[model samples]
Target chain A: MPHAIKMQDKYGKDGFVALLLESQGLDASDIPGFMWKRFPTNKTWLSTSGDAPFQMTGGGLPHAALVGVDGTLLWEGNPNGAPKKIEEMVEAELKKSKSGWGKGAIAKKARGLLYGKNAFVDAAKVVADALANAKDDEKEDLEAVAREIELRREAFKKAPKVLSEDARYLEGVKAAENYAKWVKGNPEWENEANAIVLDFQRPEIVKELDLEKGLKKILASAGDKAPTADLAKSLRTFAKKNDGSRMAARATLLAAAAEFDPNKK
Target chain B: MTLSRLVRGVGMVVVLTTAALAQLKVGELVPDKTFAQMLNSDGRKSMAELKGSPVLIDWWGNH
Candidate 1:
């Protein structure tokens, strides 16, 4: 299928015109006259040639001026204050054609598609697809690659998330929570998740839960035995002191702590 | 002086032989031909073309 054309905001017509004007050391006012002349209303010009007259505008303009249909500067001025050498234009066109501008848009779309999903699952699908389609000679190596992708995906999936019912999910959730905390930012999910993860038996998860000195108090209360009950009590205490999401997070921590079992066989 | 000159000539021959051996020959297609095809479908054929001679098929990484 022909790739969809996504007009990149970075290469707008204004940028192209600006680049042309800057190169020529002229202003936008200098552009309208020559541009209209070369691309007269009666004459139908290719999109590429449409910008040729704008090249007279020199350095005062922005880089936005030179963007053309295919990213080639349709009107780069020569040293002599004329449009760039015909040979240069021809060479540029050839290079642009060979480079294929449509491919960039396609790649960008593909990248967006990949990043939009949960990274682990999306990456696994990509690897699986690659392996399934690999040549016979490459099939052997692709198995290892597929396995690696699967391993990573499994690790990510098993990693804990805030509010995850599973203990394993807490690991990933805790990491995300820590990251959010360190940034002095609180994503709603991460805050909620952190509360749940903090209720886990893991000391690291508890520490990052940032229950102030309550985490230490809970740790001190349960030395050898499970601190699950102690952690739950501390969470209730913390909840009483905080408001809004923090209160909710504390309540989740209390609930999660009650379910945690340090002596699970 | 004559022995040293002979040894130098032999050394040069050995170096030249090693260089020739290291040079990649034409028609050595990448084993991952299907990958090339997939990449080509996504508009990455030019990369595959650079892998060898004969048919210069290219492939590209989509982002």
Candidate 2:
């Protein structure tokens, strides 16, 4: 929760925006109070109930996904887990003109699809299709991914039963695996699932690391590649083709940087 | 710094930025997932309205 706020604070001025979606069927009355205390930022906070984009890709609660200025999804995971990479992408986006990449038709289409209907199922289908094409040896790893998606779907399916009883049970979706055992032990909690007390606890984050300096050092050594002028030309074409996509914006920014000739100018 | 060093620095930023761009597996297309209706102090809002800038969508609850 605090990390999201910190990120907005650090990057908001650089054209970064953060949004919080409460996917659980919680009572809306309690959100403002929670928001006032925990996340005081003016960032958009909304309450959502059924299928969401995060249901497919998120590891758990507090999951954060980064959408680049041009509309591409740059990173998705715990915001704290990859602080440096997030900053790297944000910095890259900030370097571009605000209107350059995000206004294109393709980028808009992609963003719309991400926020549109049946996203979880769509993501699962994507996984299933990829798995179908995978070699036999890759089955185990792919199956694990598929299993997780199925588990989440099952968990989401079981949520209404629990939420109908108590609106505040945030862990109900996650506790689907333990539902059978829990119901057998506590009969009352079978239908009134939210009333069941969970023994599970959340682990605390230990440390936050900064790796950008090291990454910059490695970059300094990576000087030999495509010629600046050639890269700039290719990137401009890429930007025009991709239009409002994140790659195009990033390419446009990079192209300008590459073509900078100090001696000539 | 010397002109050569300055040029190298610029090259480095470009190199690292390109590498970072390559790491992005998912494009910016928003999923067509069913979103619960959004409400706030004002009224209703859609996720699509959040486009035109970098956004961090936190799919979380009061857990």
Candidate 3:
């Protein structure tokens, strides 16, 4: 954990990011970009953790993989044994991508500008200046970049607001997911976002999370051949236990699923 | 109720996640997919999903 923290400290802001994946015992506060692999069912871990983009198969622990700007794996090894190799690869990657992606020189300049300052107005100006003399096709491409920047900027602003709107509880999980996605990456707005994530530890929220763990255990037990009557009976008891809380509703819904039959229609 | 029982229950989805391929090689494209089979922590975009940038994925476990 200390080594992971040190790595995040070293490269978290400098044209690089890290993901702390695959842990059973962790809170959101453990790492800035802490995450886990999420299951496909609607019964997700708050939909907070992301997909394993690597699609990796059998490999032991304490591993590392370096992916470059174009999403290609550049290196893989046990990080404990090959720190120097990882650092050298990172340096090589930075030369290829200071940040952002674009094929042409001017479009590349706008992308680099967008990454450097994260200022849509200034990045848009870079595009506007180029658009003045750009060919028709080039103009369309520049306009698309400008739109992408604007959408990102809007999402950044909206995420924190969405998080703030939801009271910190089981109900706020979606809001938490949104904040983690959009309000992140920008250093200026990050602290405010982190403040919201920390709120998940509120006693009320923690209680609900504990209850949720129990709920997951129940779902795990029901399996594919769960007796409908038995499952519904368990869900009803869970709903009663959860009464007056937001999760009571979720319990009710899961209870209905226990009773639902797909072939009815 | 038992750890072994829980393991057996989860093994049902093992087909969706576990493919016993060799380790990832350099130059392969990493596709973001179902991570439930893979142990995950909290929530954050995979650096690859953040569009284009250099990313170092540290795949350590809770040891």
Candidate 4:
């Protein structure tokens, strides 16, 4: 665990994430950062869990695995025996991160297409083939990496305006949320997600995030006591105020329901 | 190292075992696995969730 911490402290900022998997049946105090350990939440280790046992070779203390940005296992063995080899592999993977990948539409479409198909090594041929059948608008979005060094620089760019420009406030917010699931081990892209959320921070946009929470109470929660006409008017108002939002769609449905509810008209 | 080597350090694909998840081998796709019950990771919870960088997973027992 201490060795893990040392590697983490040095390369963590450069996107080298050190995950310490403490095997079961030992005092938690033995972990490297013992004082900082949080319990109950972090107790179970999944790889060796009964549900799906991971087959780790060299059944001994301090075995390690190095996984790359593309989810390929680069190397795995006793760290003590191959420190130089491990570092060498880490360096090679780092170059990929610093030069490869893109964000926003480029990521969601280009790199995503390649990675989803596990055809990253053959990215150019895949893109060229896909382009042959793509529509005009989709064609504009397609870009291929002809060579490893020429991996599109757009991978690290700021949240593209296409992510938020002219889309409904919530749709824009969702774009940022989706990207949150993609990028990792850095602040620049996370900060980009924050900037995107800020782009849609208008009072109306924030209210839309919780539209359903407030809608039913205004539209029908008063039971039969609430006037049918007044409830209908409020529902209409809420829907109109939040037009194009998902909650607005629900509000429209409830507004129509007012047409048949009993309570003496 | 060559450019392809830098982007992807392709090596011999050594399938260590016959199980669903072959043992950690260079240049082979790692089977996606969830790492639940993590004590702390700034909100990251799995190997799949942590992409766009190199990940060093040190599996050790407290002996």
Best by TM-score: 3
TM-score of 3: 0.47
Q: Score residue A83 of candidate 2 by CA lDDT.
A: 77
Q: Which structure among the candidates has the greatest lDDT?
A: 3
Off by over 4 Å in 2: A41-44, A48-51, A102-265, B1-25, B32-44
> Local error of candidate 4 at A163, Å?
23
lDDT of 3 by residue, B1-63 (tens): 999998987895684456432346778766654333212222322332343456666554444
Per-candidate interface DockQ score: 0.03, 0.22, 0.23, 0.26
In candidate 3, residue A58 scores what lDDT? 44
What is candidate 2's lDDT per residue for A191-263, written digit by digit as tens? 4444332222222100000122222233243343433455557667756765754344545654564555433
Per-residue lDDT of candidate 4, residues A156-214 (tens digit): 22223332222233444655555544443336655765665576677766676567567
DockQ of candidate 2 compared with the true complex: 0.22
Candidates 1 and 2 compared: the better one by TM-score is 2
User: What is candidate 4's local distance difference test score?
Assistant: 0.54
Question: Lowest-lDDT window of 10 residues in candidate 4 chain A?
Answer: A35-44
Q: Which candidate model has the greater lDDT, 1 or 4? A: 4
Which candidate, 2 or 3, would have the higher DockQ against the true structure? 3
On DockQ, the stronger of 1 and 3 is: 3
TM-score of each: 0.22, 0.37, 0.47, 0.44
- Greater lDDT among 1 and 2 belongs to 2
What docking tier does model 2 reach?
A: incorrect
